[model samples]
Each structure stands twice: as C-alpha cells, then as structure tokens.
Target chain A: MIVATSGLTKRFGRVTAVRDVTLEVPRGVRFGLLGPNGSGKTTLVRMLLGLVHATSGSIEVLGEPMPRRARVVLPRVGALVEGPAAWGHLSGRANLRLLDAAGPGRSRHRRKRVDAVLEQVGLGGIDRRPVRAYSLGMRQRLGIAAALLREPELLLLDEPTNGLDPRGIQEMRALLTSLNEAGTTVVLSSHLLTEVEALCTHVGVMDAGRLALDSELAALRTPTGRVLVRTPEPDAVVGLLDGQVVDRRGDTVTVRGVEPATLNARLVAGGVRVTGLSEERRTLEQVVLELTGSGTDRVDRSPHGRRPEGPR
Target chain B: MIGVELRLMLRRRRVWLCWVLLCTLPTLVAILLATTRLAPPPGRGGAFLSAVTSNGQIFPAAALALVIPIFLPITVAIVAGDTVAGEASAGTLRYLLVRPVGRVRLLLAKLISVAAFVLLAVLFVTLVSYVVGVAAFGFGPDASLGGTGAIPSLSGVELTPVDVVARTATTVGYLALCMLALGAVGLFFSTLTDSPLAATLGVLAFVVASAALQPLDAASAIEPYLPTSHWLAWIDLFRDPILWTNVRGGALVQLGYVVVAFGAAWANFSTKDVTT
Candidate 1:
C-alpha cells in the first residue's frame, strides 16, 4: 500500500474528528476519499500530511511511518491541502520557483520543471501573471502544478476542483487520471459524489468523523444481486416472496436475491398492489446515503462486495 | 533558501522606503545645519551642532547617535517583526514548511535575512550621512568628542583621525549587533501572530518601554539590562584610552537577548502546528 493508517484517530476538545480509521490505499490506483461536509476527510488528510498530530494509532506513507518519519516520506509525496494558497505578489512561475527552492531535495532542472508543470497543468501562457490576477480556477491549477514540481509518486489533493468551473473540473479530472495511469497513487477528498464517481478507482466514505464505508469503486457500484419493488401492503407481500432481502421502507418494499418477474408475479398472486420494480446497481453515492443515513458511528458496505477477493 | 528570503525581503517597497528615508534624514540635517548661522541649543544638540559646523565629518557618527534612539531601531523592528508573521499572514509559510526543509532552517534563514537587512539599513544611514556631511562641511583630521565637550566624555582620550574613524566603525558594528537582539524580539513575536503590523508595533513598544524606564531611579536596577539601556554607551568608545566597560556590557546584554529570544523562537516554531 502506498498509504496506510491503522486505528487512526483525531479529536479536537470533546469532538472526535476521526475514529479508528484503518484505511489502506494501494499503489497505482486513484483513491477518492468521499465524505459530507465536516466528515473527517480533511482531518484525516491533515494527519497523514503531518500537519495535525493524530490522537492515537499509526500512519505510514510510502511504507514509511508518519510523522515520525514525515521529513523522509513527505518529499516523495505531493499534496495540496485544503485550498490553493498562492502568494498574491508573485507570478505563478516565481511562486513555483520559490516553493521548489524550499523543497526537501535540490531540484537540478527547476526551470525546465516549472515550465513543464505549467504546461502540464495548462497554465504555461499565464506563468508571468501575478497570482492575484489569476482566476480561482487558475490558482487551483497552479497549486496542482506546484505539487507536481517534484514528479512525486503519490499525490494527495483535498477538494482539488474547488472554485473550478465544469471545464476546469474536467481538466483536473484528466490530470489526476493521467497521473494515476503513469503509476502515481492519488488520494483526493471531495464531498461531491459525481466528481469521485467520474475519477476514482477506489472510494472511502466518511461520516461525522467516522469511516462509514471503504470498498473498491467497482464493488461499490456492483449490484448486491437485488431488485427494489415499491408496493402497498409490504408485510403481506413479504409472505408471498421467497427472497430474503424483503425490506419495507415507508410504503415501499425491496426484495433482494430474486428475479423481478418472479417477485412481481408472487405479489400479484397475493393480490398485492405492485407499483415499482427497479434493478439496484448500488452506485457508490447510494452506498454513501445508505451508510451515513444509517449512522456515523460504524462502518458498513454493500453486502455483495464487502470484501475484495484475491491479491490487492 | 536564505537567498530567496533575502530577495523577497529586498523586493518589498516598504524596505526600500525605510532605507531611503534613513539615508535622506542625515542629509537633510547636515544641509540645514551647514547653510544656517543659527547654533543649536546649549544642551542636547550642542555637541553635534558645534562639531558639524567646522568639520561635517562627524555628521555620520552624530547622525547615527541621533537616530539610534528611535529611527534605526524602528527600521530594524519593522523588518524583523515582518519575518515569520509576514509570510504567515500571506498564507505562504504553510507551503514553505510543507516542503522538505525543516522549520528550524526556515526560522534561521528568516533571522539571517533580517540581520542582513539591519546591516544594510545601518550602512545606508551612515554612508549617506558621511557623503552629505563631507559635502556640507569640509573633511579633515577631527578633534576628539572628549575633553572639548563637543560631547561629554567619561575619559579624556586623545585620538588620531584614523583611530577616530576605526572607533566609529566599531560603534556601528556594535550597534548592529544590538539591533539583532531587538530583531530577535520581533522574530519571536512574529512566530506568535500573523499580523506584521502587530509584530512591528510590538518591537517598537519594547523600544519605547525600555527607553521610558531608563531614567526612573526607582527602576534603575532593572533598567540597565533592557536592550535599549546601553545603546548610547558606545560614546565611551571615543574617550581617552577608550572606555570599554559600558560598550562590553551593552554588547553582552544584547548577545544574551539574542540567545534567549532565538532559542524560544526556534522551540515554538519547530513544533508549531501549521494551521494557516
């Protein structure tokens, strides 16, 4: 794993920001940290970056224990924590050069690297513009460019698409996808499910300072071999159904592990009024709602894809 | 890197303004004194006024002494207070710390950069004073600021012109070191807050308080150790056989401050959570 945390926890006064979050992100994959506002995502990311001291437990980045060894591990890991913090007085190129000079290792080809990263992030022509004049999207791109200055093997971005328009978000998605494709491990946090759904290969859901769910994106999206049916008199329809996932929510009844036609026929035979039938693809967003809606006190996942089989 | 910090320091318009202001003050005073027949009053400005009329060569030394009470220290204070807090307020300190370099190195680089600024500010003040002083009044071998009462002296030191110039250089160097302690105070406050103005005012407040307490007989016991207490003690350097007592004491006290303040700054910064 490129990043691993075991029983990690953080608390501010009486509030716990993260609780027993044993997360692991394998190398060479795009991992998305999904959470609602105030959920432990930023706190977790800060702890991993050594900006916040963890209350208990352990964290290791690139196989090195953090933050005891952050100085050694962090240089190899690139990050844009929270929002883009650009110096208003300096041009984008000057900002990158100064930040690079302050980096842990000597950058031998800084001029070339600065130009290349600027071009890579699509800010080449605007390198000379003072950061204060740059648009919000432009500043965010510069922040990403700064993170990529070292060509780090792992990148951690917190809400990297913030203040970005749709076109800018697409560009950011493309940049992160390409970085991951080229063997860079990425873990980005966002409260927007669509952003994560469109980019990530894996997803971790946090809710009110707890890890509500952790699973492969593919698994999270896969059907739990279930179908949902909305019908009146669900309790009476349950006796007519052979499927075990006969859950009644409000006036609707969902029957899992049974063909929709078979379940529909049975409900009809029992003189039950069936109004709805739909396949449950169980996208990660749905899983998020299911998990956080249940509570912020425990971890949960889709039953069909709870554990990824075989080698990671 | 220290070079980058230094560049950033030199790039600010306020820095240039401070230096430019320092350079022109002595020039204005020298020009005004040389072109006029009005002698300054008998007590405070008398020594510099009397000496500057005939030999303006003493203008730089006298200007330095005049400004030492406030101007030069204020310039240093502004720069020093801005060191860490300036970057913090700008939201740049977090990015710098996230880089591979440690906080200790960053703090050291900041202190060094400010120290260099103090050196440059003092140099500009004195150099400009010398040029303007020599222009307004003729340059020549100078009499001592000793027994003649051009300035009061603790000892009657008969000195050659070359020795006088050398002693002036030593006095300037010692004053620069004392400013380091003042700057260190600014640096420490800088790490505690993000407002550059707050830090600058903090150092100025220290200077004002220290000076305010200096004349109090009741506080005299505690006053001598204040950073500003022995600032003018360099006057004794001009005495016959050069009185070293107060000069040595002043520099040592400043050194003690530098050690304590810098040590505290480093300790606080290294473990500081970079929330900004």
Candidate 2:
C-alpha cells in the first residue's frame, strides 16, 4: 500500500474532525475520496500529510510512520491540501522556486524540474505576473505545478479541480490519468461525485467525520440481477415476460430475474420487437447516496429530525 | 530552509520599505540639525546630538539614539511577528510544513531571518546618518589635526578614528542583539495566533509595558530584569574607558530573553495542528 491509516482520528477541541478512519490505498491506483462539505475529507487529507497531527491512532505513508519519518517520507509524497496556496506578491515561477528550495532536493535540477512541471500543467508560457494577478483558473494550475515539482511517487490532492472550467477540468482529469498510468499512486478528495466516478479506480465516501463506504469501483458497480429492455410493443413484451417486468416507462420495460440473452431470445420468439437491451447496474451515485446521508450543509428548523450517528 | 527564508525576506517590499523609513528618519534629523544650526544642549536631547555638531562622525550615535526607543522596535516587531502568522493567514504555512520543512528548522530559519533584518536596518540607519552627518557638518576641527585625527569620547577625552569605528561597531552589534530579543518575543506571540497584526500588537504591548515599568520605584525590584531597561546600555561603549559593566549585563539579559521566548515558540509550534 502506498498509504495506510488504521484507526486514525483527529479532534479539534470539542469537535471530532476525523473519526476512526482506517483507509488503505494500494499502489498504483487512482483513488478518489468523495464526501460533502464538512464531512472531514479535508481534515483526513491533512492528517495523511502530517499537517495536522492525529489526536489518536497512527498513519503510515509510503510504508513509513508518518510525521515521525515524515522528513524522509514526505519528500517523496506530493500534496495539495485544502487548496493551492502561494505567496501572493511573488510571481508563480518565483513561488515555485522558493517552495522547491525549502524542501530536500538537489538544486542543480531545480530549474529543469520546475520548467517540466510548468509545461505539464500547460503554464509554460506564463509570464512574470504575480500570483495575486492570475485568474482563479491560472492560480489553480500553478498550485498543481507546485505539487508536481519533485515528481513525487504519490500525489495527494484535495479538490484539485476547483475553480476550473469544463475544459480545465477535462485537462486536469487527463493529466491525473496519465500520471497514474505512469505508475504514480494518485489520491484526490472532492465533493463532486461525478468527478470521482469518472477518474477513480477505488472510492471512499466520508460522511459526518466517518468513513461510510470503502470499496473498489468495479465491485460496487456489479450488475443488479436485472435487464433493461426497450421495445415498441411494451404490452406484448410485458405479456411475454409477465410478472418479470417490474417497471415500465414509455417504450422501456425493466425485467428482473432474467438474463438479457434469455429475455431477448424469448422476445424474438414471441414476435416482440426489441430495440435496445442491456443488463442493469447500480450507478455510483446511487451506491454513494445509499451509504451516506444528506450533505451537512443543509440545516432544518425542526429539531426532531434524525441526527447523524456518532459521538456528539 | 534558511536560504529560502532569507530570499523570501529580501523579496518583500515591506521589509525594504521599513529599512528605508528607518534610514530616512535619521537623515531627516540630520537635515533639520544642519539647517537650523541648533543642536540640543548636552545631556538634553539624543545621547550624542550635541557632540554631532562638533564631530559629524558621531552623528551615527545620535541617529541610533533617535530610533532605539520606538521606531526600531516597531519595525522589528512587525517583521518577527509576521514570520509564522503571515504564512498561516496566507495559507502557505501548511504547504511549507508538508514540504517537510521540520518545525524546529523553520522556526530557526525565521529567527535568523528576523536577526538579519534587524542587522540590515541598523546598518542602513548608521550608514545613511553618517553620510548625512558628514555632508551637513564637515569632518570637524580634528580633520586638520593630521594623520592621527582624534574624536572626543563621551568622557571628553581624545580617541583615534579606529577607536571610534570600533566603538560604533560594538554599539551596532549590541543594538542588534537587543532588537533580536524583542524579535524573539514577537516570534513567540506569532506562534500563539494566526493573525499577524495581533502578534505585532502583542509585541508592541510587551515593549510598552517594559518601558513603562522601567523607571518606576515601585517596579524597581524587577527593573533590572525588564527587556527595555538595558536598551540604553550601549551608550557605555562610547566612554573612553569603554564601560563593559552595563553592556555585559544587557547582553546577558537579551540572551536570556532569546532563549526563553524561542523555547516557548518551539514548544507551541512543534505540535500545532495547523488547521488554517
């Protein structure tokens, strides 16, 4: 595993920001941590990077104890916690240089590495404008460039696609995908479900400071023992399948406990014209919503509503 | 980490502005003294003001006197207080920490940077005031006194130019140490809060309280222990015999402050959760 945390918990005074989160990310996987705002995703990410010490439990990144061996391990781990931050008064390139110099690295390759990362992030032509003057999208790109400075073995990014337009997001996704393909373990935390669903090979959902669900994306998306059939003669198909049809909308009929091939062969034999046929599977959104509660940002006036479970 | 810290400090326009304003104050004072031909009477104005009109070379001493009380402390406090808190507020502290800059190393770098700033500020003030002083008031009646031209010590005895330069260098080093003690206090307060302004104010309040209690008979029991009580002790360096009594005592006190304040800062910062 590139990153492992067993029973990791963090508390800030009266509030428990992260609660007994035991997460494991195997090597060379694009892992997406999905959660709503205030669900402890950022706090968990901070702990993993050793920016926030855990009140209890332990963390190991790159197979060495975090923060204890942080000096040796962190140089190999790249991260963007909360968001991208740099000295506003300095140009982006100068900021990168200073950040690189602050860490453990050979100075001779500093310029070459910085230029390579800037080019990778599509900011190679960026001029000497202070970071404060860059557009939000430009700053976001610069933040990514800072993370990629040392060509880390593991990349932990929090909301990496924030402030990005559709094109920018697409480019970021492509960049992450290519990096993962090149044997870099990538872990990104974001509240955007679609973003996670599109990029991650493994997904972990956080809700109210608890890990609600953790599983491989392929396992969580197994076929639901149902097949969706579309036919102009819905009534005929329903008649042919009988009680097997559980739902119908327009020309589409949902058939349960039946293989798509069996149903298709039966339909054709029964002279029912089938236009589209496929097995049904649960979408990641459905699995996530079922495991996690509503987002924490919503507040209701009534006090009788069901409170989220855990130590208050 | 120290190199990066110094580069960051040097790149800041605010640091440069502080140094300029520090140098400017003494230059302005020189202009006023020259234009009016009125130097405050002996023992009445700044420590060496009266002597400055006679030997322009002594104006650096008067300039140091002019800024030691308030201007210098305020600038030092601002820079030191902003050391950690500024980065926290700007959201770069976490990045630096995750850059794996050890907490202790970063603190050490910041303290060194603050010391560098104080030294630079003092050096600029001394250099600028010397130039202004020589331009406004000539090299004094001693310039024609041949190769062994002598300047008067505070004790009214003649001293060679070498002695004057040595004493001035000692004074500069002493004053820098004093300001570093104050900067250490600012650094401690900086670790206590994420607000740079609050840390700066905390440092200023500390100095004010120390100054306020310095001369009070009621506080006399603790007077020797106060940070500001020994600030003026550097003046002893200008005496012909070079009184090392107060200067030694003051250096010890400042060293104590640096140790204790820096200890507190490291204790608080090492385990900080860095939520910001």
Candidate 3:
C-alpha cells in the first residue's frame, strides 16, 4: 500500500472534520477521494500529507509513519494542497525554481528539470509570465508543474480542477491518468463525480467525516446481471421464473442467474403477459446517494446496509 | 535554498522600490546639506545640518540617525511582515510546506531573506551616504565629530579619517542589528494572521504605541525593553572614549528581542495549519 490510514480523525473545536476513517491506497493506483463540500476530503488529504495533524490514528505513507517521518517522506511525495498558490510577483519559472531548489531531489540539472516540467504542464514558452497575469487555469497548471518537479513517487492533489475550465479539467485529468500509468501513486480529492469516474481506479467516499464507501470503480460500476420483470399477476409471475424469484415490487419480480430471454420464454410458456422486463444496472451516482442517504444534510443513521462487504 | 530565497527577495519590484527610496533619502540629504550652508533656522533639520557641516564624513552617520527612527524601521517592517503572512495570504504557504522543506527550514529561509533585506538596506544607505558625503565634503582630515552640541563631551579632539570610517561602520552595524530586532517583531506578528497588511500595521502599531507610551512615568519601568528605547545609542559612539554602557545594553536588548521574538514566531509557525 502506498498509503494506509487507520481510524484517522481530525477535529476543530467541537466539529470533527474526519472521524475514525480508515483507507488504504495500493501502489500505482489512481485513488479518488470523492465527497461533497465540507465532507472532510481536504482535511483527510491534509492529514495524509502531514499538513494537518490528525486528532487520533496512524498514517503511514510509503511504509513510513507520518508526520514524525514527514520531513524524510515528503521529499518523495508532491502535493498541491488547497490550490495553486504561487508568488504573484514572480514568473511561473521563477516560482518553480524556488520550489525545486528547496525540494529534496537536489538534481544538478535543476534548470533542465524545471524547463521539462513546465513544458510538461503546457506552461512551456509562457513560463516567464508573472503568476499574477496568468489565468486561474494557468496558475493551477503551474502548481502542478511544481508538484511534478521531483517526479515524486506519490502525488496528493486536493481538487486539482477546482476552478478549471472544461479543457483545463480534461488536460489535468489526462495528465494525472498518464502519471498514474507511469507508476506514480495518485490520490486526488474532487467533488466532480465524472472526473473521478474517468480518472480513478479506486474510490473512497467520505460522508460526514467518515469513509462511507470504499471500493474499486470497476466493482462499483459492475452490472448486477439480474433482470427485472414487472407484471400484474404477482403470484403467477413466481411460477413463471425458473430461478428463485423475489418480489421487486408488488407486481414485479427479480430473478438471479436467469437471462432476460429465458425469463421471457418461461413467462410466455406460462401464459403470463409480461408488461415490462429490464436488466438491473445501477450507476455510481445512485450508489452514492443510497450509501450516503438522500439527505446528507442531517446526521442520519449509519446505513451500512449497501456498503459492500469483503476486502478490497 | 537560501540563495534561491534571497534571489526571489531581490527580484521583487516592491523590494527594489524600497531600495530606491532608501538610496534617495541619503542622496538628497547629502546634496541639500553639501551645496547649501548649514545656517537654517534651528528646529527640524538643525541638528543634522550641524553634525554634517562640522564634519562631512559624519554625513552618513548623521543621515542614518535622522532616518533610522521611522523610515528604516518601516522598510524593515514591511519586508519582515510580508515574509510569512504574505505567503499565507497569497495561498503559497501550503505549497511551500509540502515540499522537502521542513517548516523550521522554511521559516529560517524567510528569516534569512528578511535579514538579507535588512543588510542590503543598511549597506545601500551607508554606501550612498558615503559617496555623497565625500563628494560634498573632502574625505581626509575630518575634525573630531564628538562633544559638539550633540554631545559636548570630548570637543577639540582631532581624529584621522580612519577612526571616523570605523565609527560609521559600527554605527551602521548597530542600526542593522536594531532593525533585525524590529524585523523579528514583525515576523512574529506575521505568523499570527494571514493578512500581510494587518501584520504590517500590527508591527507599526506596536512600535508606535511603545514610543507613544514611553513618555508616561508609569511606563518608564518598561522603557528599557522597548524596541526603540536605545535607538540613538549609536550617537554615543562618537565620543573620544566611547561610552559602552547604553550601546552594549542596547545591543543585548536587541539580541534578546531577536531571540524571544523569533522563538515565538518559529513556535507558532511550525505547528500552524496552513488553511490558506
């Protein structure tokens, strides 16, 4: 695991931002932290990077316990915590120079590295422009350039596309995807579900300062393969299905391990008029709503019913 | 790391503007004093004119005295105040902390950057003063500048130009240390909030309040510890037999403030949560 947090918690005064949340990110995986506003996504990212101290729990990054080992571990990790915070007065290249100089990489080809990263982030020829003049997207890109300075093993970005345009988000998404493919462990927090869906291999959903859902995107997106059959004669529909049929509703029945064609044939043979039949496939959005609750505004009961069981 | 930080500090337009202003003050003062006689009515510029006319080499020393009270302090205050809180306000502190750089190292870099700024400001001021002072008045054979109206302790003593230069260097050095103390205070306030303006005003307000309150009898006991209490102690260096009492005490006091203020700043900043 690139990162492992067990029962991590953070509290500000009476408010607990992250509570008893445990998560693990495997090596070279694009891990996405998805949550609504104030759901402790940023707070969790901060704790992992050792920017904010956890109230309780252990955080191990790259097998080193942090923040006690933060100074040594940070050199191998790059993060853009809140946003792209660069010196407004300095040019993009100049700001990165300061960061690279202070970075632990200490590569002698500093200028070459900076130039390469700037170009990598699409900030090539315009690196001389002062950060104050750059658009928000450009500043965000430059921040990523700084994060990419060391070619770190792990990248922790908090809402990297927070204020970005569509094209900027696309570029950032593609860049992060490529980085992860190249063996860098990427952990990003974002509210945009599509962004997470497009970029992440694994996801952890935070609800009210707790990890409400943790699973692979493929697993979350997996189709149930069960077919839904609706009819007026509920008692007759049970005999029409060969597999164990369960009532999906008063008139509908759900059958497992039976194809839609087989069920339709059986229903026709049984002389039951099938009004409607469809496969059961739930989108990640539905799963999120179901796990978090229809109204996450109030502290509702822990509806861990749908939280998938088994090891990730 | 420090080299890069100092380079960034030197590249800022604001820092350049301050340098221009500091250089201009001594240049204008030297020209106005050198070209014209020192026979102005004795209210505001009288003491400086007397000191300069008595010995032109004393122009640099006198000029520092005239401006150290407000101009130099404000300059140093702005730099120190901008160092920490400015990054926080601009949202850059979070980025800096995520690198290999430790919080202590980052704060130390800021301290060095501001210290470099203080050094440059003092050196530039003194350099401009010296060039102008020499051009306006010859460099050699300056009479003893001590025990005049400002001191009246060791008058009529002749001194070579070397001693004058040495004393001026010491004076500048002392003023720089004093400014470092002031910078440390500004740095402390900078760590408290994210607004650089608030930090700057906070520093200025504290110094102004200290000076403003030093006059009351009730505040007399705390006067010695004030940042500006021994500001003019460099003047005593002009005495033939230098008075080390106030100068040493002032240096010690400034050092004490430096230690305490920087300790407080590091303590607060190291553990600070970079919300911005």
By DockQ, the best candidate is: 2
- Note each model's CA RMSD in angstroms: 7.9, 2.4, 6.6
Pick out the ten consecutive residues of candidate 3 chain A with the lowest summed lDDT. Answer: A293-302
Reference-based lDDT, each prediction: 0.81, 0.91, 0.81
Kindly report which residue pairs in candidate 2 clash with one another: none
Model 3, C-alpha of A267: deviation from truth (Å): 11
Please give the distance, in angstroms, between residue A47's alpha carbon in candidate 3 and its true position after superposition: 0.9
Residues B114-188, model 3: lDDT tens digits: 888887888888888877876786543423334322222234356456676787789878888999888999999
Those runs of model 2 whose alpha carbons end farther than 4 Å from true positions after fitting are A231-259, A265-273, A302-312, B144-149
Q: What is the lDDT of residue A178 in candidate 3?
A: 88
i-RMS for every candidate (Å) is: 1.6, 0.7, 1.3
Give DockQ per model, in order: 0.55, 0.80, 0.63
Say which candidate scores most in lDDT. 2
Ranking by DockQ: 2, 3, 1
Which residue pairs in candidate 3 have backbone atoms (N, alpha carbon, C) closer than 3 angstroms, thus clashing?
A: B147-B152, B147-B153
Better of 1 and 3 by DockQ: 3
- Candidates in order, TM-scores: namely 0.84, 0.95, 0.86
lDDT (tens digit, per residue) of candidate 1 on A82-175: 8888778788999899888876676688899899999998988874668889898888999999889888999999999999999989988998
